[model samples]
Target: MPRKERERGAHQREPKGRKQRKAPSEGKERLPEDKPEANQLKTEQEKEVKLKSTVVDIDSVREKEESLALLEAAEQEDGLKNKNLGVFEWLLMVFALALVLLFFPFSIWFCVKVVREHERAVIFRLGHRLQGKPKGPGLLFYLPFLDVCHKVDIRLRMLKVPLHTVVTKDLARPELSVVCYYQIENVALCSAALSSLTSVLQSVVQAAVRDVLAQHSFSHILLHRRRIGEKIKAGVDSVACRWGIRMERADIDELFLPVELQQTLATEAEAKRQQQIRVSSCNGFQ
Candidate 1:
């Protein structure tokens, strides 16, 4: 190699090295000016991060608030339910207490009996009749344990006697049913006098009907039914007076006979009517 060529090469290599070193130093010097932009960029990035974190925190707070609201609403609803139940229980207790208070005193202290205008109350003490005749048509009071009360109807009452097969004076057998009208004349005596009132009254009426009917013939019974009824009324009234029962009226409601007797009576009536018709025709011809 020539000496000059070696020197020239050395100069060229030194210039290249100087250029590479100068480039790195210039880059280092420029870093100071670029620091502001870098700092601005970092600040912007920090602001974005802050904004994202703030948004997340705000969402978390909103979720917490919503959950709190839901919990509060649930608590309020439970509170309302408890309050309503308390109110209902209190009302029921008050109503029941009032009922007990009102009913207990009325049941224990007062023994009130309501008698209608057409009714009379006969008071009996220990199975014996009381001194006063009978309670009025209004209200009456009686002892609960020792006294007994019997209500008597002062209005007109009707009783129907069962069918009685009676043998007439002429030996004709007929079945008879009767209706009797009676009113209570003395309320105390009527209830106190008879052990079995309705049964005894019925039996007496039946006996009176039998006794009265046995004295009359079948034809006379049919002809004078009203007279027979009057007699029955008299007999029943006489027996019923001791029981404070007065017979207002008695009537033979229905009468029945055997089929053969009915047919015979019907035939006899028809024959008599035909004979009358023929006699009238003969008189007209004459």
Candidate 2:
């Protein structure tokens, strides 16, 4: 009986240390068998996440490097700009100093003749003549802001005096032109007595022309144009003598009227022709 009870008790025995293996027909869940595959999958997923994090860190480092590189390049560019600006400033200072050295000394040497050498200054001061003081072909000093220098011929000077036209109380227009030759005898009077040398001569010559032409009729002025120019020379000689100038000659080279005067003459000739025609017709009809 005991032996039969022991055998019966085997079915109801308490399961001790070993877990029971489920039958295949009971459809057991095999969690332990699948654990290693899950662990391998987890390792692969972790690896992928780590790889993504490493890639992100690498991109961040690259971006920071690029920013640093760009900043360094910008600093270099700014450094170059500042360096060039400093060099430009230095060059400007040098150039300003050079201009002062060149223009100042050269302009000073133009005034005040060292007359032992016999060089003269024809100084024009404030639009007025200096009158007889010779300027320097040598070194001289002038009040730079106020004085201008012109050269005078120490030798014989020739000035062309144009011809003259006479318009008397009668309105008979005529041709006129001439030239005058003169030289500076006194440098002091020549410079001091006149503002412009040419102007004084022009005024004097014009006055002489008017005077001589006023004395003559149109035909006299036209025919004796050369003589009138000589007379003008005489007048200029007298005036220039006061300023220590010598008039070598006054000569008339060309005598002519303006084009409008020539046209008037032509029209007068046509009128004369028409008059003759009328006279001939009147005679024939008579």
User: How close is every model to the real structure, measured as TM-score?
Assistant: 0.55, 0.41
Q: lDDT (0-100) at residue 227 of candidate 2?
A: 81
Error of 2 at 47 (Å): 99
Candidate 1 structure lDDT:
0.78
Error of 2 at 141 (Å): 12
Which regions of candidate 2 deviate over 4 angstroms? Answer: 1-151, 160-166, 257-286
* Top lDDT hit: 1
Estimate, for each residue in 138-211, the C-alpha lDDT of model 1 and write its tens digit.
87866565567888779998999988788888888899899999998877666655777778989999999889
- Candidate with the greatest TM-score versus the true structure: 1
Q: What is the lDDT of residue 123 in candidate 1?
A: 73
Q: Compute the lDDT of residue 150 as modeled in candidate 2.
A: 61
